[model samples]
Target: MTALLSRPGRVAAAFSPAHIGRAATLALHDELALAPKPGLVSFEDTGSHDDMDAHTFMRSLLALRSYFTHMAELGAAFAPFDALERSGIEAEARMLAATGGINTHRGAIFMLGLLCAAAGATQADGLALSADHWRAALQQHWGAALQARCARASVLSGGRAARQYGLRSASEEAALGLPVLFECAVPAWRAAQARGLSGQRLQLQVFFQIMAELDDCNIAHRGGLEGLAFARTEAQRFLMNGGATRTEALTDAREIHAAFVARRLSPGGCADTLSAVCLLHRLGALG
Candidate 1:
């Protein structure tokens, strides 16, 4: 495996631009390939989204390939937060264009974009590209800026929901170094892997773990606080009942999917975190 980080002077040769790009692409693929995801898109169904399907996700992913690579390159060059945000804006525009204005990967663009940049910074600073390295780099580089950004009122659905519900916005999550991803999602994923899980089973286990803990604004935006609570409770129940290890897991997940769709609820924030976990795993950062 190619290390995403190396000694400062040897950064360029440690990881190729294409390698960073592939990491992002593969992470998106892993998210999409996870089937029976409650209220989320998959190869088998559209989940909660009426405007997008697996193909729509593919188009959005194609549009973002260059964006992820560019963000990594910028990070490697020690670019500022404004530069990364600018690149993300351009990437978001392309994604919207590709999906006919549907917001398929906006959250992924922000979360994974930062991760990619942090990966680049870690390599540039001559550190190992571990999860801690990425977290430290993000805090050192853009933590204050992200906190400031969260102070402003959000015009987006998720942000607005966060404010209205008094829940943590994605900006706040980023500002806090994505505690949900590092402290919750990744550890659960690694434990599942250690237990010999893989593929969709592994993904579903991680997804439910995220859903159970995160105050997912998408769920709030669509379903309100009551819906968010209900969703969280259901997710907690799923995990308490043994998650993917149980024979009833798939049936239970499908039931939740049906319920969420009926209420127009989507745990998009959890989905985004899952993608980040997948990326970190791919880059060998989770360990």
Candidate 2:
């Protein structure tokens, strides 16, 4: 049986490796459950990519479950940054093998994997598992390493696109302590919650907010600067027109989804940020 830990006004769960794994899995599930997400796969439909669907994402999730737990364990042990990077590399290969070479959760694997490690690190130090705490720990422990790694050439499509378009790569985001998540996405989520939004509506609100502001390289890779501009403009319009608060919000989102599919554009970076937001929510770090 899983153990639990308690604190004043908040219950702190025991830092079992499995607990960390479950958090990652739950975050992925939350992301998948959110529907009408433009150019992203969910239970209702396959977004822009014909190569992957909800089921394909499930397979990738299963393949990486152990990786999250193991990485957390490594972090609890205070493993070096290179060690964590190697662990993610192996997990990425496993995900590719499981999904027949389609890259579904590579971005999630990197961002969420680091998050799991940060969680473990925080727990190891008996610190409260809040978003601010984890973000600070992640920077303290791996910021330099991430910056150095970002300086090297990357062979991944997203990294290549980021360089070609002069956008921020995932590694750069990590080095900067995930500015989109900490600065934009999380704040949007909190504001939505304050306004009494919950469930899928709340999730969509956060997703759109991130999409509007993020320099999503996936969009750049698929549609270049013009495509990225178009995507940001659409997202900004959605937020300005009442976002998920209006009765017609879901309908508008579906239209956006259709438009993204038609363009073969995917705001995958935003999707990753959404997943991170979900993770933080699950961990009660958003509070």
What's the CA RMSD for each of the models? 2.0, 2.4
Q: What is the lDDT of residue 6 in candidate 2?
A: 49
Per-residue accuracy of model 1 over 221-243 as CA lDDT, tens digit each: 99899999999999999999999
TM-score of each: 0.95, 0.95
| Clashes by residue pair, model 1 | none
TM-score of 1: 0.95
* lDDT string, candidate 2, 194-262, tens digits: 999999899999999999988898999999999999999999999999999999999999999999999
- The parts of candidate 1 lying over 4 Å away from their true place are 1-14
lDDT of 2 at 191: 99
